[model samples]
Target: MEKFYPEFSARFAQFLEHIRGRRIAIVGHARPDGDCIGSQVALARVLGTLGHEVLCVNPDLVPRRLQFLVPGMRFARTDEMLADRTDYTAIFVDCADHARAGERLKGRFPVVTGNIDHHLSSAGFAEWNFVDVHSAATAEVLAGMFFDNGLTVDAQTAQGLYTGILTDTGQFRFTSTTRRTFLLAAELMARGAKPTEAGFELYERETTGKLQLLERFLASLRMECGGRVCVGTLPNGIFEATGSTAEDTEGLVDYARCIDGVDVGVLIEERPDGAMKASLRAKNPAFRLDRVAAQFGGGGHACAAGLNYKGGAAGFREKLVAAIAAQIAAVDTPEEKK
Candidate 1:
């Protein structure tokens, strides 16, 4: 891939030249995370600085905490922009597939270009793809592109890049974070990225309702596989009692992962339609939650993944636990053989 960097860079440059005066739509996944939000915002800033018209389209409203990061971001909620079939270019960032853009925008535009991502699961969903799963964050990829292209990284650009790198890497604590991650982070900081301030705003700041939701999830924690796996559930009743919104449940899977003697953690949230959304976390390097999630029609990174089950809460919980247990058994069998 190193040998092809120059070629890829040249191709990307050509694509940027084509987009010079076009109306471009930058999109992220449905439920955007820091990496998704940051990549789109950073790309939008770069394009806007280049005198191109760009709109950042997010399926949902930007999280309250992230609103301050991308002040110029535009929210495109309806399918009209996508269906009009007008002369507009589409750029998807940090999404694994075009489907990740949501059904509303998929296959609606002709000239799809730009592919800034850090997920191995990305299906090369653009005319120009720049995917490096080894990178800790998509923002890292975008930052490098910006630097390579001679674009200036102002304070806001630095902030957006910092948030993307920080959250996706779990503040640089995840295994995927390497020397390159810190190197890029340091460079961004030198260009005015303040990690201390961004860290506090992104993680330290939480609402009371979110705290109550965390307590409820913690109370429902369960263990399995000789304490190698921990599971937790959040029922709608708990959400009602705590006045917690769905957004409040974001990062609750980390709680199960933090428990001592647990190699894998699972969080199941009961949806209003009786189905369940499962979030999986694996601390053990040998465990690949992405494979586990794919079995249920979902995919993500190795350590973290998610799946949606279409059954009653009881049945969904039962099947999910059994599936996770099977994966655990498969991993342990090799050790037993050894």
Candidate 2:
């Protein structure tokens, strides 16, 4: 098999050697998405097969669509795991930083054994970090590593990996989707990953409440920066009114980003406690929205990023628009015209 990440092959080998017989905690980010949950499931299953006692940990329950992937296993929530106080070697998957796994999880497991991720904003906060920013998804990185190292990737594990790649690449529509992405996906299919099943479950199973939430989000869209940017908001009480939760807000920002003239899109969610969480997406990678997210101490890929703020949604919107508008102006500025 072709080694997509040659540099990390030996490191993965060493990682396997270190955790062979140890109790392992496979941690994923908060409000886990397809890639995050998929990486956790696949890695936990792989490690379990190798004689390790593996437990998947997350700050939130698996989203409805992803629950099917972890049928026989259980995801140990941070609160419950903290209650147990079991000792394990912590390995973070799909988390850009330790805190992305949630403050409590990071606090409970201050020392990390290994980190595997594909986000540009990853801080390498572990003893061994395998971050491939070029990979479309963390599942892609793990798939390549497993194949290269001759590890067993069974049908269920393949489904988990395939689902991660499928969603993270927007069904191969994102610019981040590369030839290697397609190749790895094909390999996974051969290993028993049913795209028909994954697609039907992920897309065709949307609930009426989710559609109501989407309608509300679309109605809130506001154009900025001469229509080059679009922003929307989900007020604190909107979730209750629409019978939705934060997970239902997933992919809502894409609607703002996919507009023809829009170069960037934003989604702001107001919490009950006056805290705001914002999701940012851009059409081009050069926009480096990750840096924009970093200004507020959040992190993600260049094209997609997020941040949290301790202020009202309106104030955060003003600050975020100004930052995004400044970036647009810089991009429009003529070099020699100076």
Candidate 3:
């Protein structure tokens, strides 16, 4: 409201001047989602247009579906690309915290020149931090920055920005979706973003392997807490059996949340490291899923959050179920009585 962070434009101008003609590394968070990749590519396009050499670096390959939005998004193996970060200006995007950039990159480029993100957990990790958690998407913040700085938004830039907004807001269906989000989407469309094509590519272009993986995940869905919570797990073996990758499981958590009578959805993805990554989503505004995620050292928006647990996969699942149950119990507790 009232134009969150009025000084962002002026500060961004200063950052641009400082990094002109420099070899810049645009880093996104690990296991990047659409918002992460979109913000990175969009910002890279702007930086490149300003006569700066920019490299968009992500630890994981761009999701096959998102590749169409940011064509040829530059990606690098973390161990190889960040081995030496001596002469590069680091700019992080859509990451909540410094650690989200991975320890290797964080160690190499300790001095972050800029950060662009919309998560509340971003506690000013950069010399020039642009964290506006109020904004619906980091792409919304990026779009505002681009317009404020008089940067021309072309097809490539528009596509990237639109993708960031779409995914972060769950195609504008999430509770965070606001009038300003739609206004930003319209602005991006006017700048040549093809929303129709993007919708089909992102939502409709899943491969058979991904579909099978989803089927398996859905098959494992469990309803608990008198059907108020829905839980699903995607084991590593399921990916192998279905010939799917981590990216294929990206939005599968939403499927569980979409079921009737399920106010909270829990998705646990078993990782090769013997750990599980838990993504929690809420259908009811009364639910505070971030609190559930914080039990495992993660924090995010109320409606969406995640946690990483180091334990046997089964043990992690058991712990997560208990955590979710505790959250549900708290919701039913009377405030005054407590």
Candidate 4:
């Protein structure tokens, strides 16, 4: 067992020491991806082994594909956790900001005990913030730290960590994937993570409606920003028409980014409430799609980010396209930073 993340391991020890006795709540972001859910499952299992009473809470229900990671009522909805009288010292996993867990959960835990994440845009929001932007996924950081600490990683926990790494790395095809990423994944495999099942469940299990939904999304794709970017829109009620849920939109933005000469890809989902959710992806970090997203009160990794906000007088799609175009313009003209 090598010390893959010695410094983070040390901080994890300190985090454990700080919340030694109080009941701990592990909170995750709304509409959590694999990284969010995986980190929550891994942290809960790891902390539970330490004899601490732990609970996992999320603003949204676990997506269908990720249901395997949640075992036997391990996760609770925001209202469910709030109903419990037990006071919880919260630890946020894979959340870029304290508000990433949504306002209600943020209200539930006024004082954050810890936050573990790997998003490039992550701010140190918790008392014990363990944010390693270099790590491909927060689960990668946790897996390395858990191994470095000589902690136990059961099969389910290993599966969760592996899934998080797999998804966040774009199946190990993203630039963030490194030798260390592969090494940690191999170690997780040795610890009983089944890649075949993870891959099959995550990828091969797509429903027909998801396929139709993806078709609609791709059909809406248009080249924007002088062919440097591709944009797609999923209209409100498209989910109902296609018999799909919001989770089916996963990986749709990648198709836009895969187009030739497109430096950035955008997906704007029109919600039923006149609000919008957008996902941004870039072929290069210099495009700084996260910075583009930050303009709309959302942030994430440099190459990948998202935001959910109501469209204003200017229109969200028009505004978002302008922001992205501006980002590209800045990159195109290096002298524009002023």
Candidate 5:
């Protein structure tokens, strides 16, 4: 058990010490992605082994693919957790802010005891915050802490950590993937994480509806800002027509981002209520898509961010394109900063 993130590990150890012997409820964001669910599962299993009563709570059900990581584990939906009315120490995992945990859960735990995340937009809304925007994933932070403290990572917990690291790193292809990420991934594999299993569940299990949804999204691709920006749309009825869901739109935006010469990629999802949810991705961190998303009250990493607007897709797209153009113009004008 070697220490990778010594400073973060020490801080996490102190946080754990403060909550020692208390009943803990681990909270994750609304849409529990691999990193969110994996972090919750891994931390809950580790903390439970440390003699604390722990349960993972989320606003939504675990996505179909991520369910495997929670097999035989204690996971409660937000409603269920609220029904308990139990007094417990609240720990949030992979949530950039308390709002990301949903308004209901945010109200339940007005003051978070512990907050662990890796999103650059994290609001640090906890008494004990261990946010590492540089880390690839929240699970990466917890994995480092687990190993640093000589804690045991059982097979299931290892799989959870491995899945988080794998997905958050974009299969280890994202810029955030560091040498420590690879090394910790290797350690998780040694501890019993099966990459093949994770890959099959994550990538190979795409549904036909998702493909149909992706088709519509691709068909809506439009280049702006002299082709440096690529924007796509999923119309209001597209999901219902394709029998797909919000989860299906997960990696669809990447298709636009991966295109040659596209520095910024945007996916605008039109909700049933006419609101538009925009997911933004950039190849270079300098673009600072997070700041761009913040203009619409959304936040995320520099390379990947999102926002929601209560307006028509056409108008939202126009406004977003203009914002992105301004960003590109500002970046091009290095003299402005000076």
Candidate 6:
């Protein structure tokens, strides 16, 4: 076997030794996506087999699409785990920053044991921060680490890790998907990861309400920056109107980005409480959407990023457009012209 993560695997061995006898809480970000939930489950199961007591914790409930990975497992939310008082050593996974787990969770676990992630903007916030920006997903980082360190990955863990890679790679169609990703997926299948089942759960389970929501999103699409950018807005209360939830916004932005000549796609969700949430996806990694999201205190990979802000959507939209537009102009203009 080729050592998938040779360097990180050695560090992982030290991490395993560091927390040998401690109870662990695998904390994930709020409004958990496939990668977040998948990484949490995969890590929890692996650690559980090592005679370590482990629990999965998240700020929000596992979304519908990712529920398959959590069978027979109970996830502790903010209140449940905070009241347990188990003295859990926090191991944050797939979170770019402390705030990604929500302010309340961050306050509870100010000090962290380990942080494993693949986001380009990941902040090294833990004692053993294993971040590989080149990996397509945090689960990929963990899978590599586990395989390299000779850790056991049962059937369920394989599915969890496989789902993380599948979703984060845009179903293996995104530019981030690499040879290692496919090779890992193949190995995972040999270990009992079912691609057909995962595909059905993640994609084929879309409801009529979700289609309605997508209709609204498509209708709201507006081309900007001379058609190079496609922006869609979901108005406040639109979820109620469409009979859909935030999770339904999952792949809506991709429709915008897949269009011809559109370099970037955006989905801006307006909240009733005056907070704004935006999802940014770029066809080209050169767009560095993560940097654009960082300007607003959000972060992720270069091609995909997101942000949450406390303000009117319109005001935020203007600022976001200007930033993205500037990025576009920088690429368009010749260096000598400047």
TM-score of each: 0.92, 0.97, 0.92, 0.96, 0.97, 0.97
Q: Is candidate 4 or candidate 6 better by TM-score?
A: 6
Report the lDDT tens digits of candidate 1 across residue range 1-338. Answer: 22223435666688888678988888788778888888888888888888888888767777877776877577675465655555668888888888777777676643468778878688886888888888788898888777767787888888899899999998889988887677778778888888888877787889898999999889989998789889999886677789877877788999999898898899988888877788999986467788888887788888888877775665666677777788878778977332
lDDT of each: 0.80, 0.90, 0.82, 0.90, 0.90, 0.91
Candidate 5's displacement at residue 236, Å, is 0.8
CA lDDT, candidate 3, residue 247: 80
Candidate 4, clashing residue pairs? none
Alpha carbon lDDT at 334, candidate 4:
59
Residue-level lDDT of model 5, residues 32-52, one tens digit each, is 899999999999999989899
Q: How many Å off is the CA of 282 in candidate 3?
A: 0.7
| Residue range 1-338, candidate 3, lDDT tens digits | 24433669888888889888899899888788888888888988888889877787777777788788666556665776757545889898988888887887778778898888888677788999898877878888999888777787888889889989999988888877888788778889999989888899888887899999999999999887789889998877788899888888888999999998888888988888888888999986456777788888887777888988875665677777788888777777888122
- For candidate 1, the per-residue lDDT at 184 reads 74
**Model 6 C-alpha lDDT per residue in residues 1-338, reported as the tens digit of each score:** 78888879898999999999889999999889889999999999999889888889998899988889999776999998778876989999999988899998998899988999988988898989999999999999999898888889999999999999999999998887899999899889988999999999998999888999999999999999999999999999998998999889999999999999999999999888889999999988888889899888788888999998885666688899999999888777787132
Report the lDDT of model 6 for residue 277. Answer: 92
lDDT of 4 at 306: 94
Model 5 lowest lDDT segment of ten:
308-317
* Candidate with better lDDT, 1 vs 6: 6
Model 5 clash tally?
A: 0
Clashes of 3: 0
> How high is the lDDT of residue 164 in model 5?
95
Q: Pick out the ten consecutive residues of candidate 2 with the lowest summed lDDT.
A: 329-338
Off by over 4 Å in 4: 334-338
